[model samples]
Target: MSSTTQKCADMLCHRNGVLKCSRCKGADPETFYCSPECQKSDWRWHKKFCGKQAYVFDVELLGSSNPKITRKVAVPSWYTFKQFHFVLQYIFGPWQNCHLHTFSFLKELGNQRIRSDFSIRKEILLELCHEGDVEYVSQNWFDEREVKLSDVYEEDGRLRSKIMVNGNFAPLLYEYDFGDGWEHKITFVKSELARAARPLVKEAVGCGPVEDSGGIQGWNKVKEAFAATQPTTEQLERRQWAREVSGLEERYNPLAEPDVIVMNYEGRWENHEEGYREDERRRTAF
Candidate 1:
């Protein structure tokens, strides 16, 4: 007789006969073998549930008249910003998440479901979604959100939205044939900040970043697309916030950025609390 429910040994999971493995698409493939030892032994299959090493970085960088300007950035609480996009891709897919970035994506990722702390790391949170399929539902703002219980497939990314802007959180898909394989992508309009300026920065002085746009602006966005830069955090204030977010701080390199592992508290929305203020050192042009 087929059992209605089974405990999964791998992924520490529980399975209803109706639901199958997302990674294997296996139907009740004896997930639970009735022992903790059985589950530990079955981790090879569970390992597939995780994606490629999350730190896919593109080394292209932006040029600045001032050398002190951030070559690296860090987002608060997270070491690897790829964790965000990885979850989005796993929950949705690369193309769907690309469609999610068309607007003021600068502030759209801040939703409760988006930041839930299921595990010490955000990537592990994806494990919860791996157990089921995700569906997309439109918010009144016209943007889409995920519903794992309702939809068969869901994939996308969103920024922190303070004011709701109505638009479809829809997927705009793209494809590139690599001969050996077809690479898919999602297309969307990208916008740049128009702050009154200092010197105009280029993605690279002579050689442009991989993106054809070829300006400081292009570098910022392109590095991410190329998987070069990940959002990083530099704790402007350590006693107040750095201690809260950092796991460990070891020296990065000598000569230039000696304090390579700077504090990153990007999501903090508090008053600036710097005790000592020194005029920032000016950088001679490189």
Candidate 2:
């Protein structure tokens, strides 16, 4: 009944809670979820920091021809997965909203993958494994929107008694711009029991490729084109367009200073900003 749990965790959603974060209730009785649908939808990023003091995650951009792109971030436990996605997008730049993405959990034993559906209106599809074989278990998957990091993470051996104290759990996969096959591997580095006002970038390495520059192969091509001496007219034009799309004007040299981290997270909540701007525009129009 705390003020924090009085409403759903989703800012866009205003549902009063009948459902709460079961894992968080043991410590903080807040963090209630409106419904299973909301939990499933928000699971990816929320699971990183929910009900904990703080969480450190190591993120690496996958499928890039170059393997140097990576980032380390510290986030407040209460942030939703949707919020986390924006953080990744800012560091990697595409900066613009122009891609489809999904968060997936994969296991190596039998190559099983549990993915969260963007639309959580339907029943969740769970994967059951036995002796390296996998099968789909109906009605067993918890909606991602309703789940939080506290739900999946266990520090005191309460959730998984058999899990060793030092064992590392499965990593999460964040696949952005599916067409470009941009994948990121997220590993839980550590967690603390203190609260954070907001997420922060702890470290950053290597600059990501231009937005929608194909996949690994294409990224390599763009790099080569930029590095070419006496480049062709076509390559020059391509670079110009890339600079605009990437928002990197004179600082577009990847080889010179590629390890910088850009923090522009406010852009993610632009829809909220647009409304106010539009309202002011209407008032000024007359």
Candidate 3:
């Protein structure tokens, strides 16, 4: 049912509700509540199946090491690709949205993998394209602003027909920071409703890499240097380099827990909307 017309799932209340169940926000037959009190009151019955089914994903940073970085997140199916990008940034290092990114779809053909002809990219990339690049942009790219997660995956969490290869769905690839080549493999883990309208992190492992600390190889070097017990001269220099580059007064720790709360707050779509509107106003003023 459309979000606007949905009624409170509390059988007795049946009020036209706006708040979705924290654990079942994106379920097919979505559950809602008019108030937290109603939701709490209904918990006894609802808890049985609240988060049993929904859109869940495992996002792993492709080249992380020392401990390997990964996160399990529950995302609403209606989220746009742009929103997904923000979610990734939040869960990872709370990455500074300083670079361009793309979402690629790949199909398996026998033993070889082929990237789908088209990719979804940030809207700023399209805006930056010159007139001469219009055809190329149109043929190879889709604006992330226009595509929802549901457009790529079915309500049942299966890949849609057109994009499926040999009746199997492929994991989606997200590449951020073209210069650093920070690639993340996004694998659909299960069909389960998320806890909120915003993506929720269910699990997190290892620490996110330092921005501009080079790429995977550079990050690995930093880890090796810091992990050393009896440091060699070169390793000491490397540690010094990492500190300077990362703006850390002390050695970088690869195992520390990320500041997830701050990340989620900064990455909220509402904050993005405010920034986007301000940018639009500036552009129009000029």
Candidate 4:
């Protein structure tokens, strides 16, 4: 993929090189504007869902060598990206849940924009550039604890202006486990009324690679060991190691694909707390 980035989305500066960019708090997290003025001017249309809204994000693991990892999640507009991180842990079961990660809000670029309707026009300059093309500036990084999901959103529950003003909606870049180098592209798919206070996993595909299974490559080896009709000593050891850490030694399937679990917590809201308690009881049962 080319390393080129799109110019800011501000209409006034149609040809002006982008100085800075932010994601929209409105319906599209992929659209961005060049300046705050452009972002605010467009807010009239975006403000509709800025309050008490929720979003469904399509998250896919980037840079995976094999077994594409993806999930569709429903979370409240008020959740901090940090809270959503936990929800991912529940679904993917990252190794020991001990990993370092960061979220980048810059415009989605290159092949990462997989949506068929996704536009590359934002990356193009309609008129000859004149503003002495500003050098690409690095986006500011915030610790998970420092920002809430709503921090990037507007008061009405739209995405924060700072995140969307200077650029078009870009996927929320979440790279986890630096050692494993698992990069996830989190895109805001749609907005809706809040279902409940807790987060939900609407759909999931592909079991998350075992944590620290040597990133994608190691993960592949682990899979082969499990699928092996007659396993090698090394394969058996790796398989056993994964089982011990995940606490699924007894039922861990070497040849089985990850189960497809579709959970809508909103539908089971009344029973969720009890379910959690029961899960805790089982966790301690052993």
Q: What is the lDDT of candidate 2?
A: 0.56
Best by TM-score: 3
TM-score order of candidates, top first: 3, 4, 2, 1
lDDT of the candidates, in the order given: 0.24, 0.56, 0.64, 0.56
Once fitted onto the true fold, the runs of candidate 1 whose alpha carbons sit more than 4 angstroms away are 1-86, 89-143, 146-286
Candidate 3, residues 157-190, lDDT tens digits: the string is 3335545667655657777776787878788877
lDDT of 1 by residue, 1-286 (tens): 2346665554444443333334433433444344445545665655433221111111211132222222111111121222223322221111122212211111222222222223212321121221112232112212122322112111222332222236432221111111211111222222222111111111111121221223344324433332323433322222123122222223211112212211122111111111001111111121
- Candidate with the larger TM-score of 1 and 4: 4
Order the candidates by lDDT, highest first: 3, 4, 2, 1
lDDT of 2 by residue, 184-244 (tens): 8888888764223455667777667777788767777777778889889978876777777
**Cα lDDT over the full model 3:** 0.64
Higher-TM-score candidate among 3 and 4?
3
Question: TM per model?
Answer: 0.19, 0.58, 0.63, 0.59
